[model samples]
Target: MTVVQVSAGWVPLAAALLLTVATAAAALDGVLAARAGGRPLGEGLLTPAAETARLFRQRRRTTVAADLPLQRIGGAGLLTAALLMVTVVPFGRWTVADLSVGVVWFNAMDVLLWAALWLAGWGPNSVHPLVAGHRFLAQALSYELPLMFALTTPAVAAGSLRLGDLVAAQSGLWFVVWMPVAFVVFCAGVLAFSAWGPFSAALGGGATGGVLAESAGVDRWLVTAGRYALLTAGAAFGATAFLGGGHGPLLPAWLWVLVKTALLLAVLVALRRRLPVVRPERLTVPAWLVVLPLVLVQLLVVSVVVVVRG
Candidate 1:
């Protein structure tokens, strides 16, 4: 399948699409929370818009010795990371960059997210936020290797790093069907990087809102939006890498891509605040003891199957 790359000038379309999906995720999360509390669904739907307006009207709050420039960069860089992640991701038959090394590109973006998040924490120069930043790095160290192996599984099976080829390789069977472990790990990686759900220790699970401890006003909004954007990007990429990107009956390919991405994004959002927060300290233990070994075994299984088929 030939994926047409849109001109660089139309990159805003990608950004628009990401924002749209991110907004939907936010709305879904709000609605779920409302339902959980037995509140009206209409009020839940208005949550995102209301929060945005409230934050917009609020004044900026500054720390005693905050690194203002770095703080601002970190806040903005987070949303930027999500934008870059989607550049290589195709919406059905069209993509922005179409890089042959799309898989590695996502890997690099995840690393960039580490830097952005750390900066967000460090720039505040506050104790809890600083601690939160370090906690995320600690949490990242545990999941990253297994995450890498999970990512490698599909590329190994498809025998190419190109996402289009990976998608095409799933014509007969979605990778998620045969590579369930990888798909699970991949979703875990998404939540971890987004600082969401059970993986949100860095966002103030056991501590004082960790990275969010010192944020205020517009700055706070940016960081919050960034997390949603990252989750949205992950869903889009995961749909491509695992769920057989855009391959479905009846609906147009692009619509199928949107539908799959939304479904995955919805699952991730509904799970927020519902699961126990994995303490940053204890997170490393199970991540290493159980998750890592399972993904490694999954990788080995994939390698054997690929070799046998060859």
Candidate 2:
């Protein structure tokens, strides 16, 4: 048991370190790609980084009427929340921290989105930021319920809320196989929740960018970094929840986890470029009233399978 426990503990740490390294490499590769296209090395980082540089090179203009403290707090809070959410994610056989109510913890962390966006918007005290915040709020309401239902489906099927157990239960067949509808719903929710393509209404050019328009300097950088980290964590969770976590033929468990996560992130990146944003109002009705019900039904189906199998 001691040996097993030690292995289990080290595995997750190793996986996380590996993931960090891979993210760094991916950033480097982006830089190289940009340079090949005659862009500066600064342009190679994630879109947010490139955007931040652009913001930095431009003159910093502050609205005389803005709440400085709130703006600072908004930027700091976004980074903090994104980092905290990562702690609960399972990288391989273990997570940075595990709780009995891991699924609940994940869901609870998501609630922080409202405060983060609100602060970001309210601090700017500008028309654009205000509009962005309201747009984000509307988008958040649309996607979160379906996301919650999709998240619960796997927990119900595995009969555990712990992310580690959820991954373990997929040793044979992935949840995506049994709960295809839930998988689609979860992926869609992830894209929307992260405000990625097809759900990036909050950040589209006309609508305040939505709240980021008012941000500049380090404040903007932090928010952008947080967004990438959040997306990474979301991809990791999706891999562990629906795809088999670090389980595959031939490769070491850690490598398997890395492979799966990379694949998922690549898919997300591809979708980011390919898909177009949908308006918040149009998405809400379908995502909540339609997708949410389908996910609930998927949960019921998963539960029935678990019971019957047992």
Question: Quick one: best TM-score, which candidate?
Answer: 1
Which 10-residue span in candidate 1 carries the lowest summed lDDT? 203-212
Model 2 worst lDDT run, 10 consecutive residues: 1-10
lDDT digits (tens) for residues 1-310 of candidate 2: 0001234555556445644743553475476557667898776778444665676786645786998788778766655665666566565554666777878887787678777777778887888778877888898888888888888899998888987788778888988899999888777776665666777776553445677787776777666666555566677778878888777888777667777777787677557655567888898788767788888888888888888989
lDDT score, candidate 1, position 56? 94
Whole-model Cα lDDT per candidate? Answer: 0.90, 0.71
Give stretches of model 1 more than 4 Å off. none
For model 1, how does the per-residue alpha-carbon lDDT over 259-307 read when each residue is reduced to its tens digit?
A: 9999999998877757978877888888899999999899899999999
For residue 242, give model 2's deviation from the true position in Å: 1.0
Q: How many angstroms is residue 146 displaced in model 2 relative to the true structure, after the best TM-score fit?
A: 0.6
User: Distance from true position, residue 266, model 2, in Å?
Assistant: 1.2
- Per-residue lDDT for 31 in model 1? 91
**How high is each candidate's TM-score?**
0.98, 0.84
Model 2, stretches more than 4 Å misplaced? 1-61, 205-208
Q: List per-candidate RMSD values in Å.
A: 1.1, 4.2
